[model samples]
Target: MSIPKRVAERITNRIKQFQSILDAQRARDVSEADTVTLVKDLLSEVFGYDKYAELTSEHSIRGTYCDLAVKIESKLALLIEVKAIGTELRDQHIKQAIDYAANEGCEWVVLTNAVEWRMYHVLFRKPIDKQELAQLNLLTIDTKQDECMERLYLLTREGFVKSALAEYRDRKEATSRFMLAAILLHSGPVQTALRREVRRVSEMLVDPAEIDKILRDEVIKRECIEGEQADAAARRVQRSAEKSIRRASEECEGSEANPNPSESPPVQDAH
Candidate 1:
């Protein structure tokens, strides 16, 4: 999900320059038309879309119009539904865009208000499902953060042309297994392996049932990585924990050297 150095720099600068202004406008209730134009500008400047080509607003499905579409080599890739900047994206909004995608045979549909972008994968299989693959909230994100940019990069024109978003979804699904492994409650392989490790490290023999009980109580701390998001915050938590451990270790060394005087080990009570 890494963007090219040049592309990343451009996006970072654009967000830094425009986010506050956009926020002020959105606070005043910008019109849908204006939001759509902003979305196009984001596509062109941040996502690498050529405004004249590869991006279109005239796309229609069975005479019904989608707000925007991205095409590669004359093939429609995704349909987008734009709402006013302050609009809350709902399931109905997503379904509307998905209906457009399905009718047009487009595999992806996005619903956004220039503030929050949500991407869905349209499954063509029976019992049709619109699975949400990713989402980004521009309002709260720090664009300079690597994890933030990585997710945002998936929606770029180069990303869409190269199927980077799809690849990102696949990678997320695969990595999700590890996250599940960390917190599985069932007697799954992950749980079994963890129990084995616990037994190996325990001072006394540990029972599998004990591990199950402990897990049911959910006493073990775990960090969850959602979708394609990086574990950046988790790393911060780990560093803090390591610092506390080192401080404790240093205190213990000092205590040992000075020998906390409990009257010098009861002073010679035997005397």
Candidate 2:
């Protein structure tokens, strides 16, 4: 997604400014509280959030407090869990961040140590799940790179208002390995094409079951073919196919009913 030049400039400038502060803080092994302070400052200066009004430090959720929350116009945008500058961000930290988001019915969460920032999209399913959308290290990020700027933009106030982050997550999931594996394995057209290609190459009949077995057993990763995530991806593909079929059916019926439907005449401008 293309970010506005003005906003991109601010993000570039702020990231450059914060890189030095984060580097010094990391050298001192700053405390979590100090890290939160830096994060809040980043949110305000870089992300265009009001430090006092939009960034809340002690956000309560289910009798526990998350380190920081980004709330704009009284709407909660993100729940963040901060770690000390010296601490490495881990799965446990993401779990805690997603837990806060899940409890508060928030869809987004962030885990950061004022240097490395990780953004997650929380999925509220049978058990809460999260997908890491973007991870950027201020120390290593190149402010001049368009990709780095775009990644940082998704966490900014303008990006949140424009739903860029959610769009980015959707785009990531749409072409994800799990989604591709599910489509390759279960899609009818894909299966037919595979069988046809095999027959063409070998000049022999290949059973569908054999192809399926090979895919399930050897070709695709076990994680991509097995487990809850795989199941969800398959369901999503099925739903998309179903919707396309329905739309085509409706269009066919319309054409059959009104084969020569009249088109609207163009309106003339009254200049």
Measured by lDDT, the strongest candidate is 2
* lDDT agreement of model 1 with the native: 0.76
* RMSD in Å for all candidates: 16.2, 5.7
> Alpha-carbon error at 200 in model 1, in Å?
5.6
Error at 63, model 1, angstroms: 1.3
User: For residues 28-116, could you state the per-residue lDDT of candidate 1 as single tens digits?
Assistant: 89999989888888888777788778788998778877789988778998788999998888878877787777777788888999989
Model 2 lDDT tens row, 149-204: 88999899999999999899989988988999999987878889999999999999
Off by more than 4 A, model 2: 259-271
Quote model 1's TM-score. Answer: 0.66
Q: Write down the lDDT that model 2 would get.
A: 0.89
Clashes of each: 0, 0
What value does the lDDT take at residue 213 in candidate 2? 95
Flag regions of model 1 displaced more than 4 Å. 177-271
Residue pair clashes in candidate 2: none
For candidate 1, what's the RMSD?
16.2
Alpha carbon lDDT of each predicted model: 0.76, 0.89
